[model samples]
Target chain A: MKLTILGCYSATPRTDTNPTSQVLEINNHMFLIDCGEGTQVELRRNKIKFARIKHIFISHLHGDHFFGLVGLISTFRLLTRETELHIYCPKGLKEVITLQMKLADSWTNYQLIFHELTSTESELIFEDDKVQVFTIPLDHRVYTNGFLFKEKAGDRHLDMDAVLNANINVAYYRKLKQGYDVVNEDGVLIDNNKVTTDPNPPKSYAFCSDTAYNEAIIPIIKGVDVLYHESTFLDQHASLAPKTKHSTAKEAATIAKKAKVKTLVLGHFSTRYDNLNDFKSEAQTVFESVELADDGKTFNFD
Target chain B: MKLTILGCYSATPRTDTNPTSQVLEINNHMFLIDCGEGTQVELRRNKIKFARIKHIFISHLHGDHFFGLVGLISTFRLLTRETELHIYCPKGLKEVITLQMKLADSWTNYQLIFHELTSTESELIFEDDKVQVFTIPLDHRVYTNGFLFKEKAGDRHLDMDAVLNANINVAYYRKLKQGYDVVNEDGVLIDNNKVTTDPNPPKSYAFCSDTAYNEAIIPIIKGVDVLYHESTFLDQHASLAPKTKHSTAKEAATIAKKAKVKTLVLGHFSTRYDNLNDFKSEAQTVFESVELADDGKTFNFD
Candidate 1:
């Protein structure tokens, strides 16, 4: 799995810092998350192909979170994209986008599908053979949802030498990989464990942003391989976190520690703080594994 | 008068080139023209203060022309701006912007006033003591209007020595600057020309973009000091100009020559061309004075 941070700063895009936008490449799927203003330019700057973004997930209706959505949609139409694009966002986003498109009179030639999420409970929103995505309900000023992307375990690897030694027919190899015992060519029953090894462990990533210090999401994102949480403020501005429905660095680290995530990626930093290392040091005080997210940063998980 | 080109490309914004947006500073007023995506960042790159932009003029409803307005508006709110912002755009833009704000539940603390223009004829959209802005209706796929920023003639320069020689009272200085024949301190009628010289000729700038090769706007922008016109294609792709409701570099030059504009500034270049000098050369063929508009390029008319 590969994750690219197109933008990570908060509260309006600046010349050097972008608001919020990321690209996650998992199991041949490139998912765009929280397209803030200037996100399209950031994507271009990062050299991410626009066509690869088949699914877009917006956390909330905040301008910093999803203002670039309409521009991206319009760009897709201008590029004459033919593939269907899916948008998973809050309830009212569809109306907003539709109205803009209606006013511009530039409808997309491709299928533009909107999956509005209004449920307060955590639920599965998307699933395929190799990947599953669920909504992690978050507490924010508006109706918001973070997304959890989990990869499904692959089939077991075949022990070629062991299978040949056991005189297992090639047709029975499929059953062996499926964790089943099958009859060999000699009509002898063979154990699956003897011919095949276990598959690689699946990985999971959780993205949560623009939320207060709510423990309710810790359960949903528990034990995630990588957890990207918004740390819009530091200890000095802790009082403003709750009032603004944002999380401080220590608060995000606490949530990551409680959730037992393998890695905590801190992002959505407020532009007021000039030193991002402060957030890293603060988060590390509570969580041992903490990484700072900056614009154009990339992380690869194996 | 100073004009800063934040973005001057056509269609979708890319990593290096922006779609359409510029800042025109005339007579102390900073007017934003055609705010495309990433305009706020461009504004920052250009070192333009957000508070100085009190008015924004959008050429049309095309995504490339005004996609950045909403984000800029939202940023102003985040910055706690209390000044009133006036937006002059085509009809239906207000609904589009209002709906997005409603969905986000982020109403601006500053008053956002929209002047929706549905006029097909050239009309005055904004006026002040120092500057006057008029719409130059252009033919395009959608309803569009270019803007003409004309600096009002300044007070006449007083011939200090001549004023003293004529024995004009100091109290009549204001009247003398206004080109009135005021009575001198000795009760002698003074000729206005004898004491004061004519004011500097008012500078005018016409911005026409995303338009076809229509001569209808020639009369509206005729003999302007500077004319920034859309030149989306070179002569190689001249055939596609009218079909796409755009103009070629040669066509823009032709219009500039016919309108007797002092300097023709070509912009809104298609991303297909790698060399921008070709646009300048192509335009210079028909017009003697041709300047190319580029991102981050600034033009000053003194």
Candidate 2:
């Protein structure tokens, strides 16, 4: 799995910095997350294959988070995209997008589907054979949800040396790889482990942003492989963090530590500070595997 | 009167060129003509005071024409603007803006007045002490209206030399500037013409964009001091002009000539062409006074 940060600033878009948006590539699928203003240009700059992004996940209605949605959708229409696009966002997004289309008298030619998320409980929103997506309720001024993308366990791989030593029939090799016992014409039970080894460990990535420090979500994201939690402020502004319903770097790190996440990625830095290293240092106090997300930066998980 | 071209390119937003949007400063009022994507950032780059914008006039609902409206409005709310804003656009624009506000639950604290235009006949939309705005019926697939900003016949400027020579009382000077034949306190009759001259010949700017070569608008914008018309294509692609409800350089210049406009400013260029000089040379053949619009370029009328 690989994750690319297209934008990771808070508040407004600047000439140098951008707002929150990212792309995660997992299981040969591209998923766009939280498209902010200027996101399409960022996608162009990053050379992301925009047409392959079949799914979009929005965190909230804040302009810094999803203002670029209308333009992106319109650009897709202009490109004459044939594939259907799916959006998982709060219920209000559909109304906003349709209104813009109505006024312009322009609608996407391709099928556009919206999965309105209004639930507070952790619920599965998207699922396929390779991956599953669930919502992690967040505490914010408005209705918002975070997404957890977890890859499903795969089939075991065959150990060729063991298989050859066992003299497994070539016709029964497929069954051994599937972790099933196969019997020959002699009517003998063949051990599945003799020819097969365990599949590679599954991976998971979680995205949480524009939320206050809440302990309830720790259990939901327990042992996550990678956690991207918003760090809007440094430890000095921890007093104002709770009032704004935003998290500080230390607070995000606390959540990551409690959740036992392997990697903690911090993003959505507020415009108040000029330096970003403070966030990294603060987050490292609680979690060592901490990294800051910068625009056009990509992280690969193998 | 001063006009600033915020963006003039047609089609999608790119790295360098911009879509249609401009700011016309007439009688010390900043009236934003059209707002395409990334206009607010352009406004910032141009050093335009955001609070001074009291009115916005949109010619059509095309994405390139007014996709930046919602973002501008939201930014105003964030900046804590208290003055009421007036948006004059097509009939369906209000629905789009209001629906976006409803979904985000972030309605402006300031008053948002909308003057929806749906009439085919010329009609007055906005009138102030210094400016009177009227719509010119346009031909397009959608219901579009071009706007004409005419400076009202101003209060006559007092010829200071004549005022001092006539020995007019200081209190009566205000009456003389109002074009009144003021009788001196000493019971002397003073001719209004002798003391004052006609206030700077009521400058007018006509904006005609996203329309085919429609001659009916000539009478409405007749003798305009300056006409800004969209030259989306060159004469080489004139065949595609009418189908898209756009105009070529020659066509725009022809309309300016038929209307007897003083000067012609060509803009809304299609991104297909790299050389902009072709438009200037082509339009000059039909109209002698022609200027090209570029992003961040300003034109002043004296």
lDDT of 1 by residue, B1-302 (tens): 89999999988998889989999998899999999998998998989999999999999998999989999999999999999999999999998889888888889999999999999999999998999999999989989999999999999999999999999889999999998999988899999998899899999999999899999888999999999999999999989988989999999999999999999999999999999999999888788899999999999998
The superposed Cα distance between candidate 1 and the true structure at residue A296, in angstroms, equals 0.8
Instruction: Give the residue spans of candidate 1 off by over 4 A.
Output: none
Q: What is the TM-score of chain A, computed separately for every candidate?
A: 0.98, 0.97
lDDT of 2 at A149: 95
Candidate 2 residue-wise lDDT, A157-226, digit = tens:
9888877777668898878767899875566777898778998889999999989999999999999999
Model 1 score (lDDT): 0.93
TM-score of chain B of each: 0.99, 0.97
Tens-digit lDDT track for model 2 on B1-302?
A: 99999999986787787778999999988999888878888888899999999999998988888888888898899889999999999888898888777777789999999998888899999888999999988887688888999998888899998888888899998898788998876689999999998877889999988889999999999999999998999999999999998999999999999999999999999988999999999999998999999999999987
Q: Report the number of the highest-lDDT candidate.
A: 1
Among these predicted structures, which one has the highest TM-score? Answer: 1
